[model samples]
Structure formats: structure tokens, C-alpha cells
Target chain A: MIRSGGLRLDGVTVLLADGSKFTRKLVAQMLAEFGVGTILEAEDGETALDALKRGPVDLLICDTLVENPDGITLTRMIRHDNGATYRSIPVLLLAGHTRQADVIRMRDCGASLILAKPVAPKALYDRLAWIARDPRPFVDSAIYAGPDRRHNVGEPPNGVARRQMDRERFADQTKSSVSHDEIMAILRQADSL
Target chain B: MRKSRFAALATRDGGRKRSDAVQAAESQLATMEGDYIAEADRLIAQLNVLSGAAQPDVEAIYRVAATLRGLGGAFGYVLVSDIAGSLCDLAERLGAAGQVDPPALLAHAQSLSLLHHRRVKGTGGDGEAQLCEGLARLVARWPAATLP
Candidate 1:
């Protein structure tokens, strides 16, 4: 259940990258129910990227099959670029098929969460809550470790080690069951030009 | 055309009571499952043509087939379900290939379209029931058709 008590995400912007008009309308309606102030819509990943360049966003909910670039590609680009203020922002990927492999791929690409399509309003709300109250702290604890002592150690220094640890943490967050072959096949069928 | 035909059949005989009309309409609704499946089949045919493009957007096809499988089963069109399942498998395969075989794809599309038309015309008895049976037969034979 979503704890709506302190859930005032007013003025937060949610960008949606979906080709389906019906899905966009449905998500907009669901977000409105949760008191989201402004909602932005994009038919594909290219448009969403352009929108991101213009400013920062609080959340991004994208379909796996956006018209251009595709959701995973868009997510990777966003995470890779440092100029984008929303680079670290939470991303929720919606997949038409609830394949575990797809979920894992999305997570690997830096998506905060993945939801199977035909998403229920309640499920969306719950995911939003989890994103909103992310408790993980970001810090440079390695700065506290001296280089000489770290050098004597077989592994890298604390900062480098912590960075690796963070990568592993995000890697573990991926939740996909679909085989790589299945995803590749779907991509092949969907690719144009 | 189909709706009109059902409406005309409903008006036949002196059973002109409102309740009788409602019952007739319900029966017609039950029988239209074949029509829906046929419509899906027609769409699949169109998809075959479109899929030959460089980037075919096959995910859309998979999504449509998934819907058909669910709805067909819900409406008691078991044959439709089977056909939809096969279509789903084909879509998955196409996705893996990342390309389309125009000739083979066209043949499969034609088969789906013809199956839909035959079921919808209810060439035999109770189009919906026959469609259900046809879908079952298609499913039984899918393993063979799907094999490389």
C-alpha cells in the first residue's frame, strides 16, 4: 500500500515515453489521482531525450518499445551523461511482456524499477512511493581511508572499492527472467531501418 | 454486414417480445467471437507486409497477439486462443531473427486470414463453436508449422 501521508510530490514532473495514446492517457489519469502536478508526454525516446535536455525531471516512466532509440538505450544515455540533472532520477520501465529477462536488462541499464504492461493503478502508486522515499544514502566514505594503507591492501582503495560496490548493488537490483535469446528475437522483429 | 444479418435473424418468427429480442441479441453476441478472431487474423496479415521493413516494430505485433490470446480464451473462443498463441510464438521467433522472410511470412499470414474468414462465415454450424474447434486443430499442428 502507498503511504500517501507525506507524499506531496507537487511540482514534480513525470515524463512518459510511450507510443500508445491510450497508455499515455491512462498513466496521466493515474498520476493525476496521486496528485502529480505536471505530466509530460513523449511518443518516443528521441523526443523524451530532447525534453530532458531542456530541464530536469523528477521521474521518468518509459515504455520498452519507444518509437526512437528505445527505452533501454535512452536510459543508458541518460545515466551516462553527467550534464543531465535528471541522470540519477528514478526511471520506471514498462514492458509489454512480463519477461524476467526484460526486467533484468532494464535494471542493468539504470532503470530504477520495471513494471509489466497493463499496469494496475495501485501497482503504479506503490512503485512511485518506493521511488519517492528511496532511503539509500550517497557518500564518499573512501575519503576517510588513507591511500598508503589502502595500497598495502590487495584490493583498490576504499573509494574505488565503494564505487565497485555501488555498481554491484545496482546490478543486484535488476529483476528479469526472460532469456537473452528471447529479447534479441523481439528486438530483431521490432527493428526498422 | 454481420450485425445486420444477426439483427434480421432476430426479427424472424412471431417471438417479438422484448425479452426474446434481448435473448436473441445475447446469442448473437456469443456467436460473434469468430468475427473478432477473424478480424485479428486480418491484422496479422497486414503485419506480415509491414514486418519486412528494416525495423518492423514487432513488439506491437506481440502485444496484439497477447491480447487476442487472453480475450479469445475469456470469450470461449478456444480456437482463437490457439491461433493467437501460435501467432505469439511466431512473433517471438521473428523478433529473434531481427528480420523477416517475406515469402514464408506471407504464407503464414494468408493462412491466418483464411482461417478467420472461414470461421466467421461459420461455413458449418455455430461459427463461434467451429472457430473454437479450428483454433484447437491449429494449436495441435503448430509444433510442426513452427519447426525450422
Candidate 2:
């Protein structure tokens, strides 16, 4: 967690879990320019765990293929820890691939954000700025503030029917919850073919 | 037993299965090699701009050299890895001392630059090859973590 100080800019401590010395240095330099005072480096997961034990870290920036304990497993450990200090810290996972499966896996591992590696300095700075802002509560309305507003529609005046009709027009909405007997009958019909 | 069952499954393999396994290994190796070449080329280009005495960022130089040393061999560029390792060692020594002889460092940087140029042109000499070999030998003596 970041300690509150008199400085207008927040004091951020970053833990970098990357095997690439070049990338670590570049990130350290960039964060320094962004007013981050404390930057910890770990070339592998084992060292990263050691660093975590040394002090309270505000943010963790980890590479996907860290030596020994990989980034996903590290994130799981952080998320599952009973300690308040460890659980509250945000994790940002970095990887070379932008594959959707990789992003999904990182998210499932409790990563707050996923960044593709070879990141530009400006983009990195922007992400840091976002992380510096006060984190929203998990159950906050902000989580569902997306384009999928139809899910929120309720009965009558809320236009639930209209939304349901629109959804049904595009695809079968009730097929997933059909009764087991109905599904069996359908399977039987298919078997006859 | 489970072990006996597993042995029975293993016995089902044929020549086609063996060839498929070999092909998979070859493909994986090729993909890793391609990724290595791309990353090395990018790092080499970045090194060209930063390798000079006038620059005061010792940590950055050490970091780049260290990464090259760690990754070059994995990517099949042992020569580049070896030279980078030597540079990292010198950079670390300079960093610890908090001061460096700029002229000497610049000369070393020049040599590295020349090697990079020769590698690019595919005309590296026996001396360059020997320098790379010497660097590799030096790197073998240092720990991976402290070098970067």
C-alpha cells in the first residue's frame, strides 16, 4: 500500500518480476520519471517472493515467464494470502502475447490488469496513473458500467420485455435452460437422423 | 497396476507416431529460434543508440548487456551473448566504483559497435570471434542475477 505523504504526487513502490535486465532497467527509469521512489527488482518468482516478505509493496508488475514460480501462480498466492497488506496490493501481468486466452487466464488469476510486453513508455505511464487512483470496491456499480446495459433491464417500465425481445430476435435465449426431458427428446429426434 | 496400463498405452506407438513427435520438436525449436532472432535484432538496434561514454546511465547499460547475455544463448546467438556478458561485467565494476574512465569505456563500446556492424554485414573476423569467446569465458565466472 502507498504511504500518504505531503507530496502532491503519490509515493508508489513497484515490484518488477522480470528476467530481462534490460526491461527492468527501462521500467525503473520510466517509473522514476513518473515520481515512483522505491523500485524493487526480481529476476525470478523465488526472488520476487523474497522481496514481498521484505516490505509492503504497493503494486506488482510481473512478466509471464518469471523463473521458478510463474506470474500466474504468484498472483494466486498474493490473492489467497490472509494478510491484509498482501491481499490489497494490485497486480499487473505483462506478456509478449496479446492472445485472448492469455488475457483471460491472467484475469482469472486475479490480475487487476494485463499489459503486453515491449510496452511504450507513455502507455506504461498511463497505466501507472490508473493504478495510482483509489481502487473501487469489488461490488461497485462501476464494474457493470459497460455497453451491456440490457442485462440491467427489469420488468414493465424498465423495458425488460423489449430487451428480451431484442435478445431473442438475435438468438435463442431460453434454449440453455430447457428441461432435461426436452433435451432428451431433442437428442432422440437427432439420433433417428 | 497403473504403471502396467501406461506401458501398454506406450506400446501402441508406430513409426508415424515417432515421426510426428520428431516433427513437433523441430517445429517448436524453429519457432523459438525465430523469436530469439527477432528479440536479438531489436535489442541490438537499441544498443547501438545507447553504447557510448557520454551517457551516464550505467544501470541501463548493465541491464541491456545482462539481458543479452541471459537470452542470446537461448536464442542460438552464443557469440552475441558472450560479448554482451563481458560488457555487463565491466559495466557492473564501473557502477560499483561510482566513476568510470570515459575514454577506456568508449573504446570498449567502439569495439562492441564494430562487432555489431560486422555481425550485421556477415563479415566478422577471427579476432571478433575470439573476443566473443573470451567474453563467454568471463561471463561463466559471474552470477546471472548480479550481472543484470
Best by DockQ: 1
- Which candidate leads the pack in lDDT? 1
Candidate 1 is scored at a TM of: 0.50
Interface RMSD of each: 23.5, 31.3
Error of 2 at A137 (Å): 2.1
lDDT of 2 by residue, A36-145 (tens): 55889999998988888886676789887576887877876766665545554667777642222344556557665566444433345435434444234322132221
In model 1, where do residues sit more than 4 Å from their true spots? A1-6, A98-104, A137-193, B1-60, B63-89, B97-148
Writing each residue's lDDT as its tens digit, candidate 2 over B1-148 gives: 0111111222232212322333343344434544555666676655555654366465666656655555543323344555665666655656655654343333334444544433421213454444444444433333333211
* Candidate 1 local Cα displacement, residue A143, angstroms: 22
- lDDT value, residue B55 of candidate 1: 56
lDDT of 1 at A84: 54
Please state the error at residue A122 of candidate 2 in Å.
Answer: 1.1
Residue-by-residue lDDT tens digits, candidate 1, B24-142: 33344455445545556556666556545555565666666554443333233334444555556656655655644433333334434544444422122343333334334333332
Q: All models: lDDT? A: 0.51, 0.50
